[model samples]
Target chain A: MIRGIKLGLLVVCLAMAWGFPAQPAGANSDMPKPAARWVTADHSKFEALKQDFKSGPEVTKACLSCHNEAAGQVMKTIHWTWLSPDAPPEAKLGKGGLVVNNFCIAMPSNEPRCTSCHAGYGWKDKNFDFAKQENVDCLVCHEQTGTYKKFPAGAGNPASEPKKMGPETFLPPEWNKVAQSVARPSRDNCGTCHFYGGGGDMVKHGDLDSSMKNPDRNLDVHMDAKGANFACTRCHTTIAHKISGRAYKTPAAATRISLLKDDQISRITCESCHSETPHKVDVKLNDHTDKVACQTCHIPEFARKLPTKMRWDWATAGQRDAEGKPIKKKGPLGPPSYDGMKGDFTWQKDVRPVYQWFNGSITNVMAYTKIDPSQPVTLAKIDGDPGDANSRIYPFKLHTGRQPYDKSNNTMVVPKLFGPPGSGAYWSDYDWNKAISAGMAYVDLPYSGQYDFVETRYFFQTSHMVAPKDKAVSCQECHTVDSRLKGISGVYMPGRDYNRPLNYLGWGIAAAALLGVGLHGLGRAVARRKNGNHDHQA
Target chain B: MNGNGNGNKPLYLYTRFERFWHWAQAVLIIVLAVTGLEIHGSYTWLGFKRAVEVHNFCAWTWLVLYAFVLFWMATTGEWRQYIPTTKRLIDVALYYMVGIFQGKPHPVPKSERDKHNPLQRMTYLSISLILIPAQMATGFLYYFYNSWALWGWGAKLTLSTVAFIHTAGMFGFLAFLVVHVYMTTTGHTLTCHLKAMCTGWEEVGVPPKS
Candidate 1:
């Protein structure tokens, strides 16, 4: 017993000398610094965040005290302006611009509801100052507290106090607490606007949804919360808050990033880290990189967890019951199939993506663009073909819809969809002519006073929800008859495409040779059998 | 020369080296045909990727064998043997077509200097000198399709045309194989020609030279 005690004492001494493996920096440390090595300073200690604030703009005023040039920098970004200057001027291509889409139409006469998701405050009209530094909502993106909630119809303003509207009670944030928690944008920050783009989760982009916030490895290998756990700022590496990536108007080409990341050409492409030849040298798949984008093979299907809105028919909207109340019908999936205010909707889960030859650019059909009434309007056209050197096969979610169009003008009409009782909104008055007239007057466009629902097709690129490498599509999926790439033209795939006449001729010759040889052998056998006694060996 | 089978002297129609290459060429051609057809998606036996690798390998082996054959033919003055002859060509054709069924003697038979008959010389010459060489050229062009842009005229060349020519060549080879195999049976006896190919000696029937 004495010897055992002596040995235990020696072991304790050795352990003490070496120091036990570090208890997590917070669990056992006497005093842990708030900021990590990467963060230069913690915002909680800043004097500007110590004061209580009245509004989100007041909080932005405080943030600007230290980050002086931040608002000026943000005003130039697409997120702040919602206008793509890179697009053709006549197209008026962006959210704030006069571009009409099948979903919610345009935002001109519907600012109160639509501007609630805007990065800045009080953008209720065309006169909302785009240059005001205090209007920037800094807490919406950077606040780690996650307490910020914009009022549903408050024009990008969070309530100063608890304000109940409909079913949701918008709670006012503790301004000091939210302001103190400022940092870089997280996945939740970007998801606030992007995930709920078409007014609900998984409504706009099939690849983006609330399920992506903390996905597992099976859903996305890169952004898996438990694995890589990469923040949005990781690949969308921003400099001066410009957020170096594509815009509403797609870029015509992708810039290759240097391996060291010092080249300043960070384009949020798969090639940013994975070069053009991602597969190892001599691999057959490596050769396909030139013709096929990473997303085409990596993301087999999207909306894995949630069913996304696939189609909407605005023509079937505005049905009321005997009591004059709005009607709603539940879909096969969880969401409502028909809402009296909106229309019929089709939702799909685990949807296979459509493919296109994309050079990164697209032709957006704007409100001013002329249309043919006989056919479905192509809202956006992917601009590339197999022959284009910049082109590669990319995957997309092709959403089809029917919305208001002008029969007289041969152009799409933006309907006033969201407003109060006297505002002549389509949802309120249930009148297409009144809503179209109000909407056309707001955008300063002439109303033809003729309205009809025309079918439209819109395409969104599938870049996220990338399944694991093991779940990628097999070779035979695209290389066989009735293949996934069946409708694609301008290139010949071997097993999928065969020259029927040449094949028939080649096979015919081989068959004929066999048949001829067999017949000749049979004839010689018959001749020998008939002349039984003749010795004709020579 | 007139009565080859009746010659009494024990004759050797095939040399040892010639028999080796002929049998080797037959096996190589069969391998190339099967793998080449598989690569064309005729059927999925051996799969696509394996078929291409194997086809290329067999084609290279055939080319090497043909190169040695060319060198041997040049040095030994045996290139003259493949020269086409109209001498009794029609008679030989008629013999195979009509007379052979009636048990008439062969119009042209294997001899010391002319193992290949008039018809054999024409068929073998065209196949070895024309068809196979054309096939090899197209096969190589198809294999190096990715490098087409490097060549001035190659950019204008379509893969479909190259592949079609190569596929047609495969059919030609297969047809040749069927007819050539059947013709081996039309000798003096069923097994005599096969025996000569194997042992390099022909047993000239019914007499012994003195």
Candidate 2:
């Protein structure tokens, strides 16, 4: 029998060896060179670099002289227009200019302050032309000097000269020097705006923060500065100034071997490099790929290095101190739980992700999208179901907050958050009516004259801070009692739960067997003794 | 081995292969039950990861031993011993429940060709025919779950249903084990049946005249 079993195993092994593909010989021959050697064009030698630029457009005019098509390429992008290209036509509110958000409401009346993050100049009002190519700010992304600082209310232009405001003096960056030192976009360039998304550092997407700029392998294996040393562009590969890997739009699955290759790849998913079956050591782990998402196990948690805003209540924005000045409240963590400029806020650190099925499509609520004020509004709905073959479990950061809504119209209301003193902005006058009217008129929407706060939630998918394999969420984390997937339904999880009737029936049968065994034992003992006494008499 | 002392010799009931298979199966079952209960979340004597490892190891061991036992039984004609009969099934059940308390004789006697009584044959048949196959088939399916679609069975049986069936078979094994152990104590002496299993001989009462 042992020899037969050995022979069977040997035949199976031989068949597998004959059927499997052989490993390629030189897998690393095509590895990319270091980023320092990638740039061959010397920008400092160009005559355009010798110009003394007075404003952001002046620098852009110099840049366009040599790189003739650069501005045109940027002009067609959302970064320059602040308008989404594929927004539903009837909504007319897909762009950042008209969209309402839980934090700071709308960008219409607050363009001067909000456009500081925009990659162009002079978006101070509705009159800013979307067709203007000269307004594209190249230094915002390519500046290697680390000195280009766009101040709030600058309308995308860096401070040209030192200026003073409220108790703080702002020093201008050397624009000529910065323009001369342009190179590929570094982590600092992307981190400048994205890291401070919702008015502050680590305020919006929980998975992103300033810490990612130089993360160690312990924090993120892919972007580890000492190991893989991946820049943001490594994954969000760009072509013709169009960056890929936007979470708002993604593919159902990744289908490419190389991220840099121009192929049919899921630009936003981990599967792009890992493939559908990444666990080569354990086939059992790979089997979970159809149902469990890579991030659900790999990410483990978000906001690892900083506390992110978990909740925001705009209704509490008007609170003031004894001196009638807006007051700030700090939570147990170092970050403020409430800022007079914003509202009541709650922050969290090292937060576990919420799991859900996503088919990589989202239907977001537009600015004028009719909403019901009676219940918490889903600002964006991830489209998928448990039954969808294309859908896989994904991790999400569910950001909850309250934003202004028109009480009479039963729709979301965008409020002007920043303006000059006496301009009737919420930050300046603490008046909701004036702010709402100004913001609503800017977007060509009607204000109902009466407004209140309505609870809102935004589902932000986590796609970064992937930990090492040893740090991934363990099997027991989702399989044991009161597991992380506790509230998740539509699928059965062994060890986490069992059929109650089946459990009772098992116990009942065992009890009956024990009862019969005990009674039979007693009867047999008595019968044997009685038979023995009869045998003696015979 | 002590007999009834009515001039009847002890019968050679079990063979060497049967004795080895029985003891090996008993040890494997005990290991399986210990780890199985832990994996089922009944208690935490062994941690979940370790419990799963031990359970899988024992399951594979039992599977290999089971295959060998099947071959042994087939070649030795011991497979016919477990063929169930309804002839005295009710009488044996009655003896256990009520008639035994009134000191009535046993319903059926053991023999070389038909070693098991009616109740023992039916119980063993159910275990070998229904429960063992259920566990083995379901266990194999789970172990190779990733290849379910490759086998063109994607929509047929879900992982949950397969797992439930395996757990149900485990419950059956547990009940059988308890009853089997208790029935061993029903021999002429306290240790009589155990010694018979170990020595391949069962001491019985006086034989009737031919």
Candidate 3:
């Protein structure tokens, strides 16, 4: 019996020691690849493409002849108007005209340089008309050729002349060739402006960068070149030239419109393709969708390929080299951490996104809006609460910075940063007073004599570059001690911080059991021997 | 009684139902402990996704089986065997602590009417009355977490507290399991208790006190 029992114990010990090997979870199913990149039609054969367009307006005229209503459709979008119809009448002028950002502050004073990213042409000042159809640049988003270039101080027009743009001789794009080579928007077309947001690459939106042009499956499974090869329109789902989703400004919730409702259909959400119950196999994961956004898990970290700007301090600007040129200092990551043209900046790569309960409503800071100088202004506030049914735990990139603001008026100020010499620009003259004064005069706003760089923070919603399911964040990532959800409040998670008294009780019981077992076994052995009972086990 | 190869008789101390309940409970407890510890972040060998599934399934199985066993024990009058008495309880404690090492006989006798010793009876009673019920209640609360807002007390209770109670219960179960396995080897033969659990019979001797 003893030998049998020992053998059984040995077998059990050996089996346990070998351990149960874990099977890898998640499927590697692929979505159907997109069609080849070649355009179906040759636009150069058309008579409209035969002429040498002298300016952007002449190119727009040729485009309007065939696609007459295309300019009208573009005008209605926030990309053109820069103002949402939902905004109050008091501040509905336009995002470019009134909205103040923490990065480079307001845009009113620096339209020539700022409008380089705008879809329309010649928005240099308040005098620029929002109703002009000819000013719309059709080739910006549709140009099939990669030669469409928008230079600084040209408003929205390509540099057609060999003009000197701050130390570089800028060559203009061939309008005749570019106008004839128009095709459907590609990654290059969208990335021209979006990738270089906040004046440089990977500065404004942490999740977006030039690396997304031909990403691998490891970088972004959805847009992988070797896999899905999805275009921007694949998810954005544009209709009548109006892109479905809006960033910087997002809706509180996706207002559904179908046979189920009569409300006007709006932007596309993650639920549009994934469906409300995304996790078909796991019902528990589906239940989590109500209170957790898909991006929170699927996209574990943002800025995976490159370092993104985390913070900037304009207070440290105006540093000059020995030759009196703007000083530039490179960080360990190869990006300029300190530039005399801007200020001090901090950058990070593979950053874990901050989680918050956001309902998607954003409150943007406008130029004329009053601000308390005592605290860092929230350039864009993500509004939501834990109790709100519409709210979900979403991932965000919080960019903290400092920018020039009107000390006397308690409002954010616009500074001229780029221009020719003697232009009263900060970069040209290094005079904050003159640059701000010129900027305020252009926007028809009063500028106080006293100016200072105030601290500010902007919140960016992370919505793209999703990885594969297997690459998604594991459960133990956020469910352990000192976990990712450490800063998040009002939610109870197991193994990551527990209640105190209950923990003590658990240990106490185990200790008592050990003592009881040892004493009982010893007493039983002693009592049996004292009774002259030679009977023994084992 | 039946005569063994060693000339010692084996008495039918446990019924088939009792033996079945004991073995079933032991298997269920072992399954629960392995999966439960994995769920508590002890190790990630099973992977959290699979561990949760196994733990929840075994918990339900154990709960349902225990309910059925309780009914069977009550109807068969076997529940009376677990009732504790002060008579010879101190003697049994002393016998285990010191008397057994000095070659003294066991204070209590093993019979059809009373198979468990006084210490075993009290321990089993505590486990069944206090520990098992507490764990079951906490486990039930955890399972129905979504419906917490519907009940007044449940609404006031935080999920962390519920999780804490459940974890505490798991530890108690672990301690009980360790002692139970060790005690099984202390019978007249090394495998005597295990054999009785399977065959419904145990080797016995005349009680010295009797």
- Point out where model 2 deviates above 4 Å: A1-35, A93-98, A164-169, A247-267, A519-538, B1-8, B33-50, B102-105, B203-210
What range of 10 consecutive residues in model 1 chain B has the weakest lDDT sum?
A: B201-210
Which one wins by DockQ: 1 or 2? 2
- Which candidate should be chosen as best, given lDDT against the real structure? 1
Clashing residue pairs, backbone N/CA/C < 3 A, model 2: none
DockQ of each: 0.25, 0.29, 0.31
Predicted candidate 3 versus true structure: per-residue lDDT over A160-247, tens digit per residue:
7888876977777788889887877877788888888887789988888999888888888767876666677766768789887654
Among the numbered candidates, top DockQ falls to 3
DockQ of 3: 0.31
- Worst 10-residue stretch by lDDT in candidate 3 chain A? A23-32
- Summarize candidate 1's per-residue lDDT along B50-153 as a digit string, tens digits: 66668878888988998999999999988888999999999998987777676656777667788888999999999888898999899888776666777765
